[model samples]
Target: MTLRLSQLIGGQARPALSEAWLDVHEPATGTRYALCPDADGEDVAAAFEAAQAAFPAWSTLPPSERARWLDRLADALETRIDDFAAAESRDAGKPLALARDVEIPRAVANLRFFAAAATQFASESHHGQAGLNYTLRQPLGVVGCISPWNLPLYLFTWKIAPALAAGNCVIGKPSEVTPVTAWMLGELAREIGFPSGVLNIVQGLGPKVGQAIVDHPGIKAISFTGSTAVGTRIATSCAGNLKKVSLELGGKNATIVFADAPRTQLFETLLRSAFQNSGQICLCGSRLLIERSAYAEVRDELVARAKKLHVGDPLDAGNQQGALVSKAHHEKVMGHIDLARAEGGKLLCGGNAVQPPGRCEGGWFIAPTIIEGLGPYTRTNSEEIFGPVLTLQAFDDEDEALALANATPYGLAASLWTSDLRRAHRLAGRIDAGIVWINTWLERDLRTPFGGMKQSGLGREGGQEALRFFTETKNVCLNLG
Candidate 1:
């Protein structure tokens, strides 16, 4: 399918003023599938103007009425699931089934979740002797959203649904590499009857369009999901203006498996956690901390499971894993695997790139890898690799396990596998991550709050907590005579 790119401004698809374009590659074959327009400063300015124009009405609309539009969007998305899935897979290098069955559907569920929460937007009043006091949660005027490429559609929805549900107009800049899906989402929003300018999408590089959105005087808040370095830069940009900011950044999350855990179940969880989306997830369990007693056994089992994973064309139903986002990313992941070996980390299983049988030769594919004996402070242990490489480290006891888990600069998400309920509860509390899964990994419910502590991110996404992030609370006092 041929896809053309345009800016979604003021509820219309308009050609970008700049003639510059980016080639959207099909990861399965490393072929340029489409060309997406790269918006310049002028385009961003127009989008900001449209958002500025739309803010007043959107913010003032009754919560119930606003929610109705959101519901319509949910319905529209449900009907076009197949299109979204295919586009998402083609754009972001995700498996077709994952895009169609999981990512797109979950995004719709998120929209509905936020829509229901929108109706509960109410000010609470308390009578005092002096005056009546009430707390009002008001929307920030215009929010600038910057989403990354890993899970483009799902992450974009994470920013958009809650921001809109909280009555804030938005101008979003999706990563140039994966902007097509976001542009399509903008088109979907328009079809569902959202007011012009309520949601504007501009495609461009970070320094050009993304910076403009962040530094724009009209944008009241900034929500960014990307690397820690980039997130820091965004936060700094928003600082002088004092614009509200929510950042979901990088993570080197750890998965700890205890001796008492069910080995087979643990192996499955670890495989999915490390290789899902080719391990590009910010919350992926990149570091595997196993109890020393089970290290050899766990390593062998994990290697066996990794060998069975099929890596190939994303469109093929039989392919369990797909290519990385691009050739550069493929090389970067392989570099990390090489670095692990140089650092004396044991290569227990797959490390080199592998082309699955009958798959296209040019695709950016990497085999799922497991490396052992790396220490907590080692490069492989401390950094967020952001690819299909898993580093293994052993711990002598529970204390060592917790210590290794918390050693990284990130505190995003972590998982624990153990049969003892008491240890699970106790360890969960001690873990510094935002979300801790017991005997599971990457099991996300749209209703649950998800984010991280420290370098992982600031603030949360999902559930009622997300609504609060998009809004500002005001205390109002009145004397009723």
Candidate 2:
């Protein structure tokens, strides 16, 4: 039986008011495992109503009380880790081990981190010469959070946890492609008897439910993570209403390798940064910038590693890479690889789709691809492929490397491998990216602000920045005469 996922409204899971459904595919096997509600305007309106009704009471509660609720959510989610892990793997087509080990745990951490943040959420107070002035950070009553399909629950909770922790009533829309884990989160919320209407999960196509959420006048803020195109639309929509918006969008990040870097450690992390999750991560270092002296060596090692990656069912523990999230995405990635060739870039390895044995024979599996002889400004090097594809560019010196790294319009993240401390510090300042890693990639500290610069994205998320984004600030002053 194919399970039918439902929208969570007023603390209940129910089918869409429109009575329509969308097929939810298990990408690893190219099969439909579930049916998700194709939420329409009615469903979104209901969610907005529920959240708006709950907002006043929920937001007025003591921050510590709100913290307790999120803690309970974290505790409940932890007990069902195995179930969530399996669902996340099936829904997102990521490796089961990755879901179990990193994704789900990080999700749990997001909840707990924000839970603590609620109790300790601080406000600014300044003592003037005569009196005192204080600032109030108050939650935006009803907020909308739309998460992308890439990391599923990890990012779903990432936006939801902080919004709720800071006392907002949320109407969240998980990507229809990976709705199962978010559905499971709703089930957990219901089981825990979470406050009715405080959190609503609407699952459906972006045009229907996502647009409704953005268009709804009741929602005070919007937090979205997806492609640049959709984010641009959301920003435009929010601007007319002057609604607060936080967007984390696309990236064409660069991984820079210097000659003096540790060879063994460089390749290990290099491969992970380039191809982990089939290169679906927005922060994945899809563009490689290498020093001339080490370019050939690093290029060869990366090619060898890319060819050896095992692509198969997500359930298999031995496989290194799983299928793409959908057939359409698979085609898009393949098309980019073809574009590379057409643009005079030579494919060093892996420019074809893979048909793994057994049940995954029909799955959307693309082999890791490395394209060289591509200049800094080529479409293949500058555009976001968002698949298992990497472009190689050799730089003559530090100045050249920095130029290549910052060549793209995106400035989300960059990874630099170098032993020269001064060079690391110097180049990091000039990289133009929001986050720069020296000798590392994908390492994150939740307390630090995270967001992109330039066309990559607008506004920030994580730590106090997230809390601040979800709130309105008011300053109070008292005079003593």
Which number leads on lDDT?
2
Clashing pairs in 2: none
- Residue 152 lDDT in candidate 2: 93
lDDT (Cα, tens digit) per residue for candidate 1, span 384-407: 889988988888889989999999
- Candidate 2 has its poorest 10 consecutive residues by lDDT at 124-133
TM-score of 1: 0.96
After superposition, the stretches of candidate 1 with alpha carbons farther than 4 Å from their true spots are 128-130, 356-359
- Models 1 onward score TM values of 0.96, 0.99
Candidate 2 achieves a global lDDT of: 0.92
Off by over 4 Å in 2: none
lDDT of 2 at 296: 88
